[model samples]
Target: MAGGRKPCRAVTARLRRSVNRRPGTASPCPWPCTFYSVVAGHLDGGEEVKAAAIRDAREGAGITIAPENMRVVGVMHRRAGDERIDFFLVAERWTGGIVNAEPHKCDDLSWFDLDRLPENVIPYVRRAIESFHRGVWFDSFGWEE
Candidate 1:
């Protein structure tokens, strides 16, 4: 791991924005991807899982979220090349707008429709998103059966 830590756990937020198209509209619809990484950070000592999710969202994406508004949508256990447990959370309600608080870590941040994800998305990430859409609760990757 980049940081000196073991048994690492990370959090990612899935923020969805709905686009409604009215009748007789000729404009191209800009339905951005609903799955976006709001924030991610290592789980600190004695920190509750939900607390970490809220903290990461604020620190990484500059968005304030409440514990009540966030829900655990899915989880991925990845060990292809690295070992990690990823927590995927879906936030329906949040306060404040989203901004790339850590520009140095991330160069670009934008919403992408689930159907039209970028080609650069990691295989596990794409799998997780698909699992999310299909309402799958748990998944494991890079592990021999």
Candidate 2:
């Protein structure tokens, strides 16, 4: 939503990995974590947005999700001396399993509760999750205005 600049389109997935608890505890714990990533050059020229989401989810997290199973959860206008638009999607159902497709690029891919996310998560990604829970459809970050 900046001036006349066309925002770059990107997609991220909020795939809930699993549930966990302390070593001997028997109580249900919060959702372990949601998946996320900046689509890795998979968005071909004018490719369908949902298609890109599916591809990203597969390549980044090793999950195969259909377009119909995905939902746009939030959009983030992110700036870190540069600006871009990110589309966040949530997929509770998918075929196949989760794996680190790009192990070289990711050091750790573990489940984390939203209330206790890792300190190293991308700032915009975290904000997008917060916005999703708040039912905020749109948000801007790293801008003074």
Candidate 3:
């Protein structure tokens, strides 16, 4: 953790391609190549994991996900120069149309097949999606022995 702060707790909201209006939808984050990523961010202080997922979906993608609509898919303990505990949640159903809620943060929003994700996806995110499909509930990334 940075500055002696506790390990960060984050949430990732995975919107499946089937649930999205179009497949292969991607939101490029000003990277060299267009990449796919889930709606993810740090949990607010005193916020529950599921609540964070719901908030991120609305704030990042303009989708309103009910608590029942969100499913806990995976939990990842990751180290990328710092420690972060990630809660991966899948939104099976939601209301309202999807839009790029944070245009300043992302270019556009799109969906891609989880099974055949593009190579540009952040590696750790891709791993979490694959694990979710495989029925794995726990995963870790960027850790060293």
Best by lDDT: 3
Which RMSD values do the candidates have, in order?
9.5, 9.1, 4.3
Please report, as a residue range, the 10-residue window in candidate 2 with the lowest summed lDDT.
18-27
Tell me the spans in candidate 1 whose CA falls farther than 4 Å from its real position: 1-38, 80-82
Q: Write the per-residue lDDT of candidate 1 for residues 17-132, one digit (tens) a residue.
A: 31111111232222233323334566776887778878877876788888899888888887845578888777788898877665655555667677777665555667877888
Error of 1 at 60 (Å): 0.7
Q: Which whole-number lDDT from 0 to 100 does residue 12 have in model 1?
A: 50
Q: Please give the clash total of every predicted structure, in order.
A: 2, 1, 4
* Pairs that clash in candidate 3: 24-111, 25-110, 25-111, 26-110
Off by over 4 Å in 3: 1-4, 18-33
TM-scores, each model vs. reference? 0.73, 0.72, 0.82
Name the weakest run of 10 consecutive residues (lDDT summed) in model 3: 18-27
lDDT of 2 by residue, 42-66 (tens): 3555776678878877876687888
Worst 10 residues of 1 by lDDT: 18-27
User: lDDT tens digits, residues 1-145, model 3?
Assistant: 4677776546555546522221132433333435557777777789888888788888877888899878887888888766788888878888988897877666657777776766777777778878887899999988867
Measured on C-alpha atoms, candidate 1 has an lDDT of: 0.64
